[model samples]
Target: MADSDMGELAPSSSMDRRDPDLYIEDGNIVLSAKDNENNTVYFRVHKSTLVKNSPEAFGNMFSVPTPPNMDQYDGVPLVQMPDDAKSLRDFLTILYDPQCIATILKAEDFPKMLRPVELARKYQVDWICKLVASQLQSSWPDSLFQWNIVAREEGDIRAWDAYRTEAPEGDMDEPRGLRCLPEPVSSIILARQCDVPAILPVAFLHLLRFPSEIYDYNEVFPWQIPERSLLSQQDWARLVLARERITRWFTQEGPQPWKDCGTSGMQCQVITLTTWLNIAQEVAVDGNILKLYGRQVKGDICDKCKQKLEDRFYHLSVQFFRNLKHFFQLDE
Candidate 1:
């Protein structure tokens, strides 16, 4: 492709330009998207890559002969994309750079993933969707064991508290809390849009811990929270009901953790029970379990007794977490 293919960059008609690095001259096809100011940003990439990566959509699309008078850019077939240039750039980066898969898998690049995931689904890019979903599932928890593992990897989650403050006057800040975790609502929105059911249970559960004022969107935050109206009424009902059940369960049943304890000594049971009662009260008001779970109970007791209490607590946490889909009405 030549610069003249896009036309000489005239001051009056410079809305069309090639992506500096992505415009491969030897590429057989051109993918174009509109930038923020309505400029046309073009990416020249191999036709085989699109077919191989999106067999259901692009592959099927190109299976037929090119119709007469079809659009072209520098003799290459042009495909107009529905995606915006910024997101399309990220999507193309994932498509062109194989090494970037590992980058998106880490917790640090979590927020950068949403647009690509959304674009991948829109274009029926199955592999990218699966990879991003797997990364998301790992970021969340399926059991108390997994939760504790992520917690340790986070290394003193209080350090993330700087992400919270009065909402900025402009767009929300990046990397809000816990390894740039997407606000629960945003995750729920993406999960719903992309049909990633595995993420919904924990995403909904995470939302239960946030302050109710977040629904207003005017609340202070470092991360973006999409408007609550975007969520379906059914989801809202599920969230509300789930919150009630969580509060009830923690209050009525959560504190009595040592009942089946086999410990011969009563000291561990007494101390553990008292600690849980305090935790139960805090959960009633805030329901921020991740933060609460990290609190240290007195360790004066013998190791065996402490181990028994901890085992029982883990079991209960697991039991409750496994029911999140049910509580969120997603089990169906």
Candidate 2:
């Protein structure tokens, strides 16, 4: 939609089209990318607007002298971009409306943020990159306190689902089964791409909870098979090894009661062993040892025995969580 008399983009060239919203009438530059059908879609936008926001990327790009015989559209210089039109549109939408960042962020789910973050990094948009990265890290459980809160929240979600399902038809609330948990494979890759290694251990732990058989058996080409996983061979191998280690821990260390448990009466000792077995079996099947911490396990045990169990659970959860780095064979 140029200011000139060109009523439609490529009136002659049917293979091309102009983005209705992005093709500003008086814009001085043109951006182009091939759509799925291999047709070039052109966007006319202001160069100064882009440069003003992403100085490092646009400044360097435009600062260079225009090459001889550069592509032109409606007398303005054309610059072909590598990104698809939709993603580029999203980038411009976020870049143009800095004041509406919170609104934009809230509307976007965690996985959807990946595109903007990727585009931000590619275009050297510092503030946008940092903003998205900080948001992603916050959504994940970074510390034990945060992890404990997540555990509680998930428990509540389960309870909520149960309540809605079991309630009378007249009392049933609106349908609610939304879980905003991040996609583990993409989250891990995004962390590596954005250099946020702190979230990796938890992400890896979440991925490990899923049976490897859910994905392709040919682990050698994990990254190539996007339908399965995008992890490199080394990362996949590390997870495989960690699964064995975790299972071994559940069988061995996880069931053992506190060192001083037997010193109590015979009933206390028997109850401790029974409680330990129940917790270990539950975690082993679910592959979520994190339940041991923060949530009190109800059983018929004395206060002293309860304290001992809590202490044991706390220590066990801490050990497994903190050692996640070693389990996944990640470098500190």
TM-scores of the models, in the order given:
0.65, 0.77
| 197-281 per-residue lDDT for model 1 (tens digits) | 7878777756665566764434223334544665678778887787777778766664443444445457766777777777777
Q: Give the root-mean-square deviation of each candidate in angstroms.
A: 8.2, 6.4
Error of 1 at 66 (Å): 2.3
lDDT of 2 by residue, 1-332 (tens): 33234322333357888887888889988998777777778888998989998898998888999865566787778887999877787777677677555664554344555667778889888887677567668767877777777565556666656676678877855444433345677667677777788888888877766555554423221221232345788887877787777767866874344445434566666776787777666655546777678657565667777787778789988988888787777865
lDDT of all predictions: 0.68, 0.70
Runs in model 2 lying further than 4 Å from the true structure:
1-15, 99-101, 169-181, 210-234, 254-286, 294-307
Compared with the true structure, model 2 gives a TM-score of 0.77
Lowest lDDT 10-mer window, candidate 1?
4-13
Off by over 4 Å in 1: 1-13, 152-196, 210-238, 254-281, 288-318
